[model samples]
Target: TKETKLIDFNQCQQSSIENFIVNGNFPYESLEKFLVCFPKLCSLSINRLVRLNYLTEKDFNPIELKNLKSISFELHSIYFELLKALFKNFFKYIEILTISIYNDNGSNFFDGEQWEDLISTSIPKLRIFDFQHHYSGPMDHFLYACHSGDFRSEF
Candidate 1:
């Protein structure tokens, strides 16, 4: 008797396994292999995986995967640097992104000018931005920067 390996895409489908999970600190190469193997995957969830820190744009290259519409993850103590890197690199085709953060350490990551620059450069295509914070700071500032005309100026 001999063991066998799945090489062809159709063969892997016929093998009768679905919904793969990669846990622990594995290299991005393994993730890439999984994505290549299962291009028809509809949903992928990465939970509490610290190895995700090593993932970058290169790992997402072969991910023109069909039916991949949603990605869900929990990120605690997320630094602005990681957010910048993630947004800059991946999720070009993603329609929805949900992120949950725990505990606010009262750190201001961006100033008015920095926020303006970030909005202009990074998230041009974003239509809906929902903030769950209790008190939002300076709504007018953001609106004025993003929109051309002023409400006061109109009146």
Candidate 2:
């Protein structure tokens, strides 16, 4: 809290930042406040290391992520609900999407049946679809990963 308080937003003018990296467990309210300072944010990456995190609908009201073009998240226990919220609010013009998931929950993330329609609706301008998810319990992980430069066809 002390560190956050030290960065006075009133003294500093609007920022010109374009990219940001963060931990997935970071509080939504705090992150939303911090990102509002940078109106030009175009890329975001969430490094969720090894921990499994459940998606929290804690009212993530990002100030201005309208210019966001690329997003990458290390998705372990995170769900589609989080992604849907982000896409609805900020990923309208997004071009690149990279995601990774780890656990026995492969089917939840790897089901690509809705990819074409989702891209058409929420992320119409999407160009690259890079994704990976896997898990293993005494057995190896079941996985489906890809880095498709052109997302319109051959998905």
Candidate 3:
């Protein structure tokens, strides 16, 4: 029903929808579809109950979206290495980000330094970051140091 509504929305040729919530897959073919369909999109929320296919860096990159500030995603089987550039480039102007993703490796996402550097350098505009991480292994087994301050810097 939701996909149908999205399709039906295509009928309104001149429509410029600002905010979109996607419950299923949005097969962008390439990220260009987001730009072509919703040029004015500011806030985007996507909930993927089932991943039809794994996402890679190539699946990202809809450039010049200055209006897009808030984005949320529910993903599975994603690697931080693969999407590092997307965080750096694709979400350059993002002020708020929310993500719930399942990953097998803890080396990247579990590391506070990586996140701090990424946020400070790449997503400089980021103000609020809400994250839910899911992993298959015992996260405690990973050797990491506990910092004195918050998880932001000096971590």
Candidate 4:
């Protein structure tokens, strides 16, 4: 007899999948495989993924996904670099992006100066970008600038 690897709800739960919980670590390898296999995944939530280090655009096989719409996550303090890499890779087809950062640690999750950079560099086709930082103020100024006609002129 031989053992087999099966992907099911029970298998997902038994794995290191942290769903809707604080301070959970998601194995990016399994997650990438899961996403590739599960095409009908509409919404995904991984709260406070402390050890989630990297998510690059190359990891996603776009042809496999058909209905994936939303992804919510709480970023730990040390994963800012990973987030930057992830954003730099993905986010082109993302219609919505929601991020929550740890406030007590004093981390700058998405700065105002970076808005132009993000638009110019990574997410050029991004239609909507929503950010929620526990320590930072709202991105109203950047939103206004992006919405105003002046922003379009640059494009």
Candidate 5:
């Protein structure tokens, strides 16, 4: 795990690091810290993030990542709105995006059509999208909606 320590975020400012991955449960504020440190990051993958329960729409900031190409993250529950709002301002150049929402219920937390529209309009260069459910239950309607919305074909 020490090899994953690409930068000493607390000690020095790393503005040149291009790819970063946080594979453990880190606070959402750490992400904000990293964005301030790594302005040229092209890829980011956070396996799990903690302390996001208190997040609100106003908590988001417009940090443009014009060179961002890939992103992957897994969250405990539904936070599609948070993700959308983040991406709307940040990840305009994203090409590959992977999102896994754990503890997903059968109910939809986000509209597939809106996601499709976001992909079409916000991330026009998106080439690969992988969305997964990490819950233990019967297959949810969200899976069906992804297919019905023609999202699966884009990958």
Candidate 6:
């Protein structure tokens, strides 16, 4: 499967690419273009998607890749509203989501309540939500909420 690797997507228009990963810095334009071209993509990983600018309404207007079920990405900071907008735009059918927050601003940005609310409202079909970070404190709180039926009680 080494030959099937898709590193540069500039000239790619493979509709049959079910699994895709962006190995390096990829512009939003290219990301949008590839997503539009790959209509049948079920799993997508944008590990190094460059954050040139904050995503706006115009950027979230794409209607392609409705079949995307699993997505993996890394976010530098907590931008819940931006994230909510992005999720609302294209992730309706997403079942599995893996996000690694590398740069959390501070303690104020680590609100577990907001995350739980976002999950319950935005991605209802989400079966597997994987969150990874260096800090284990927030994870403990999140896990405790889940195990104590606090998360379920909200639903």
lDDT of 5 at 66: 82
Superposed Cα deviation of residue 105, candidate 3 (Å): 5.7
**Predicted structure 3: lDDT:** 0.61
- 1 or 5: which has the higher TM-score? 5
In candidate 6, which residue pairs get closer than 3 Å at backbone N, Cα or C atoms, i.e. clash? none
Q: Summing lDDT over every window of 10 consecutive residues in candidate 3, give the lowest-scoring window.
A: 141-150
Which candidate, 3 or 5, has the higher TM-score?
5
TM-score of 4: 0.51
Clashing pairs in 1: none
Q: Which runs in model 3 stand beyond 4 Å of their true positions?
A: 1-15, 27-29, 49-62, 103-107, 135-155
Off by over 4 Å in 6: 1-14, 28-30, 54-58, 62-64, 104-109, 135-155
- For 1-155, candidate 3 gives per-residue lDDT tens digits of 44411233333353388998977755423334445567677998877523234443345554677888998877544456544656665677889999776554333566568787888887889989897755555543332222212345562
lDDT score at residue 10, model 2, on the 0-100 scale? 54
Error of 1 at 96 (Å): 2.1
TM-score of 3: 0.65
**Candidates 1 and 2, the one with greater TM-score:** 2
* TM-score for each predicted model, relative to the true structure: 0.41, 0.66, 0.65, 0.51, 0.72, 0.66
RMSD of 1: 11.1
List, residue by residue over 1-155, the lDDT tens digit for candidate 2.
21212223454566898988875454333444556677798898877522222443546554446788888877544566556655766567889998776664445554454566577787888999887755555443322323222333445
Superposed by TM-score, candidate 1 places the C-alpha of residue 91 at a distance from the truth, in angstroms, of 3.1
Residues 17-73, model 1: lDDT tens digits = 235443322232234455566666555555422232444433244345435545444
Task: Please identify which of the two predictions, 1 or 4, would achieve the higher TM-score against the true structure.
Answer: 4
Report, for every candidate in turn, its global Cα lDDT versus the true structure: 0.41, 0.61, 0.61, 0.48, 0.68, 0.63
Residue runs of model 1 more than 4 Å from their true location after superposition: 1-30, 52-62, 76-90, 102-155
lDDT of 4 by residue, 1-155 (tens): 33223224334422333222323555432444555444455556667544333344325433333244456777654345455555554334454566766653323443445556765686555565566555444564444334343323233
Best by TM-score: 5
| Selected candidate, larger lDDT, 2 vs 4 | 2
Residue 139 in candidate 6 has what lDDT?
69
